[model samples]
Target: MNTFHPQYLNDSQGNTISVVIPLAEYEQIVKQLDELEGIRLHVNTHTGKRPSIPLDEFVRQRMAFSKPIPPAHNGEPIGSPLL
Candidate 1:
């Protein structure tokens, strides 16, 4: 296992304010988080319907669902309110 010591920065009041970790460790953590996110998304997609179907049925159903849908509201531009 790779272990590292983190350095701390203190404020004028002599209290620890922040910590600094190695860049390699930070990159590794980020990579792990990304992998976890991918796994979570995959699981969520598969579990969208319970009692997951067999490989063949799943492929067929996925193909059916992958079909293109009609454009929205006569192709009018839609604005994102949250943006």
Candidate 2:
């Protein structure tokens, strides 16, 4: 049970236009939204009648079919080989 203290911003006519919350609260909200999105995706995928493969087999199949990424240059970070 999380509680937030939000401040309202108004326009020239004093009509509320937006709400502001603390930075930490904003970050928490974003994190919760990301988690909720992951949950929603998982639920949607599982609700289908399609057959599923073991995680290892799925990873293997994906890796076998995926094209290799070109190497990063000029000190750039390298992409994951498994991606």
Candidate 3:
């Protein structure tokens, strides 16, 4: 079993830092945080391990992005490519 006492502090900016968490609330929060961290790490690892796209593929993707998507969807430049 663990115990925690609620407390509060004010910094130099006079901002109030309230500490009203009960022990049960703190435990719940910590458990949720551990789960969240695991999820974040999993997502980051998956992203990091994604296969690298070749340079030619990258250039082709960029060129396709730069061209005005024909609005003939309605005829107008969808967006300015530069900047």
Candidate 4:
């Protein structure tokens, strides 16, 4: 449970119309809400147990997809192999 010193605005009929909270409290609430949303997204996106990848296959796929490039600090051209 949480407690706060809430301030309220009333309409002409003395009905509660709006409420105000401290800026720090408001920021804390926003941060909590963002965290809750992230948790909900994670729950919704995962359907089953994660698939496992073998180390040998992972290394082979990685090597096939990647290429070695010259370092940028040497002012070498990109994509083309250095002589």
Candidate 5:
């Protein structure tokens, strides 16, 4: 077994768990990891953070806060000479 050679292993959930290989495998593993990173970077570059509030949801929230309630009547307008 090459001291630096390696082999990939997976867990029960199909996730990469460990790598066991000689030094020769280092380059390949590094390349794969780099490719994965590149893909991630590319995706992030293309797609930025998604808007948390959609247009309709934003309008609804704005309206809820901006609506005015009718003034309470005290039986008559103040200073109108009538109660």
Candidate 6:
């Protein structure tokens, strides 16, 4: 994991309200979160199944049914695209 240098946003009373990290770190975090979610979903879906497959195979199967994440374009978001 990359070491994050986060900037804290403080409220009027000096209470930390939010943290801002580098964009690269933020993107990496988001990607990791997505992967964790995928793993969680895969586990939930296969809880009682008779046969089991590898994580990569499960991810491939899931991706086969899901829409691909659109490439970021002109400052557009990763998953969402401007139609």
**Model with the higher TM-score, candidate 2 or 4:** 2
Candidate 2 lDDT: 0.86
> Candidate 3: how large is its RMSD?
15.0
Top lDDT prediction, candidate number: 2
Report lDDT (Cα) of residue 6, candidate 2: 100
**Cα lDDT of model 6 by residue, 1-83, tens digit:** 56889999999999999999999999999999999988887887788534568878877777777775656777565753211
Identify the leading candidate in terms of TM-score: 2
Which is superior by TM-score, 2 or 3? 2
**True-vs-predicted CA distance for residue 41, candidate 1, Å:** 0.7
Candidate 2 lDDT at 47 equals: 89
Overlapping backbone residue pairs in candidate 6 total 0
Give the range where candidate 2 is weakest over 10 consecutive residues by summed lDDT.
74-83
Model 6 poorest ten-residue lDDT run: 74-83
Q: Least accurate stretch of 10 residues (summed lDDT) in model 5?
A: 74-83
Pairs of residues at least 3 apart in sequence or in different chains that clash in candidate 1: none
Alpha-carbon error at 68 in model 2, in Å? 4.4
Each model's backbone clash number: 0, 0, 1, 0, 9, 0
Model 6 ranges with Cα > 4 A deviation: 49-83
Once fitted onto the true fold, the runs of candidate 4 whose alpha carbons sit more than 4 angstroms away are: 48-83
Two-way TM-score contest, 1 vs 6, winner: 6
- If the candidates were sorted by their lDDT against the true structure, best first, what order would they fall in? 2, 6, 4, 1, 3, 5
lDDT of each: 0.75, 0.86, 0.73, 0.76, 0.66, 0.79
Deviation from native of the Cα of residue 37 in model 3, angstroms: 0.4
Question: Per-residue lDDT for 51 in model 1?
Answer: 54
lDDT of 4 by residue, 1-83 (tens): 55677899999999999999998888888988999988776766696544457978777777777778757877875764321
Compose the digit string of candidate 3's lDDT tens values, residues 33-60: 9999888878878888544679788777
TM-score of each: 0.51, 0.58, 0.39, 0.53, 0.34, 0.52
